[model samples]
Target: MNGLCLVTGANGHLGNTLVRALLGQGHRVRAGVRDIGNHAPFAGLDCELVYAELLDSSALDKALEGVQVLFQVAAVFKHWARNPEAEIVEPNLVGTRRVLEAASRAGVQRVVYVSSVAAVGHDGTALDETHWNTESENAYYKSKILSEQAAWQCAEALGLNMVSVLPSAMVGPNAGSLTDTMGFLQTVRQRQMPFDPGFRFNFVDVRDVADGMIRAAEKGRAGQRYILANVRSSPLSDLIAAANTHTPGYRQPVSAPRWLLLGVAWLQERWARCVGKPAQLLLSQVRLFHNVAQEYDITKAKNELGFNPRSPEVALQQAFAYLYRQAHQPYEDLPQAAVQTVSSSRA
Candidate 1:
């Protein structure tokens, strides 16, 4: 905790935010990315930028040379791919092992692995950090489970100090790319969703998740997993209501029956396959929404890491404002009132 910190995937949404948080705390940071040229996220930031591809062993070794804490935040998070094994699973599972091995070789003191709430099993009841997601059929969710498990195994074998943080659906500003969660917000804003699928998600701010990761790095126990999420799950209708409060013009989509949604998702998947693009909606996603609840208990994180996140409404409002600005005009061109709302939410 006393030395330099290396953040892999520094160009990503959470990773870039983590870098900013570390710098704000006066920690020397090494921002790692696959392409040093795509560093718009770290623009004007006081951090060392280095080329650190997860699969590139030599690059990782060089990146970890003077680093004491490693934030392994890089991974493939796509829900649909041409080849799930090669595109999603291998990169996550194998890349995690490679990065941890490199960290061990470099003698890094501690590591913080960014896992997802998808790795935690979801039943009808509220879930906690003790649960494992062994029932998920989604490729992305399975990858998180396998990768986190593999990371723990590798860390144990190499005698590396490591902890994992599982974040729920993240929403916040300054996202380098349009993530799936943000994309859902965009769809709602554009009135693209024909019908509400009755999906529920545990929303948290990306900045809060980054803060939780830092706390984990500083004080988390070795081999421990922390769930960084809101205490309760919010239905899609609630998100729609929040979005309407910020940007009033669109109405929430009508709720549809489960069978109707399943049919529509099947057709969407078929069309996606024919067009050689990822489906906007997948059958697995539809089924998961109906079968599992997104409720979680964060008592462990609060007691152990002092992790207290803001309300989901605040995060949703900020996300809607950010997406609106991106769609209509430049960030500087955003209305002063809207900008102030976002800035105040963070404060």
Candidate 2:
């Protein structure tokens, strides 16, 4: 299936990883970015950069011309959800609908929509693809739920091939925009422990998630959903311990009072909205951390798509390696033994 594959949001963390992976597999990738001039790093790479905004259906259709698979990777993810229906609805819900419409019109073979587990629920017995977030929670969650539902409905009625992959927390080697997962990892590495609720989170490497998405393009079942996650959930305490291995000045195993965190989370949320900054916490975010025992099922992905999410340690190593690379540190100069370990783990 070496067809022209259009990957939207190509300048994003997961999007960049996916484009590189698809290129490695000899797929002609038409990378859809909001701007083409900023793709300096991707200059020599084997990809076709097309300027497109999901809001512009015409540009979307142009990108999908002769395309076989479309990867919808762009979405506005924030801590405190936005108010005013337009602010929340346009990009996520409306944009997704537009993308689906374009894909359907162009006769695209299938689409692999990158979704989040948080889109399903704030708390539950580890929700699967079958579960969805309640509409009453907030705009962000509600938008994601609605977007997926619309995608499914449109896909079924139009006979458009579609599959969705939900990843809990995407970490490991990243490029392009900073994400919630990397933001937390960076804060923890800097010893910024705020209102520490020792809630657990299942993490999947970005490379692994990227691999799964590309695999979906070739092997995914139409109208199906897949959950990609590692073998276990890492509690905040253990995650901190693991993060310490990669960070130089990070404190190992830190905790803050739950009550203090509530106040801090609220203040952070308000400031985030006022200053156009990514918030550190929100009410839904607090609830998400409060429920510490939830988990998920990855057996379906393992059995169906041959997905194998990398272990936490391996993921962390690659993540740090990427960060350090971004800082202009030489990967070749790293300790030879560490390099060997990283290479071995990936293989």
TM-score of each: 0.93, 0.87
| Worst ten in a row by lDDT for model 1 | 338-347
Candidate 2's C-alpha runs over 4 A off are 81-85, 122-126, 247-249, 252-254, 273-276, 329-347
Maximum-TM-score candidate: 1
Where's the lowest-lDDT run of ten residues in candidate 2?
338-347
lDDT by residue (1-347, candidate 2, tens digit) is 56888888887888878887888888888888776666553545677878767898888878788998899998776545446357765578888888889999999888899777766663536567777767445566677777788788878888888899887778876455568788777666567774456667777798899999887777888878898876567766666666556665554444656666677778887887788776667665566666465577677888889998888767766676566566664233323321001011110
lDDT of the candidates, in the order given: 0.84, 0.73
Off by over 4 Å in 1: 329-347
| Number of the top-ranking candidate, with lDDT as the measure | 1
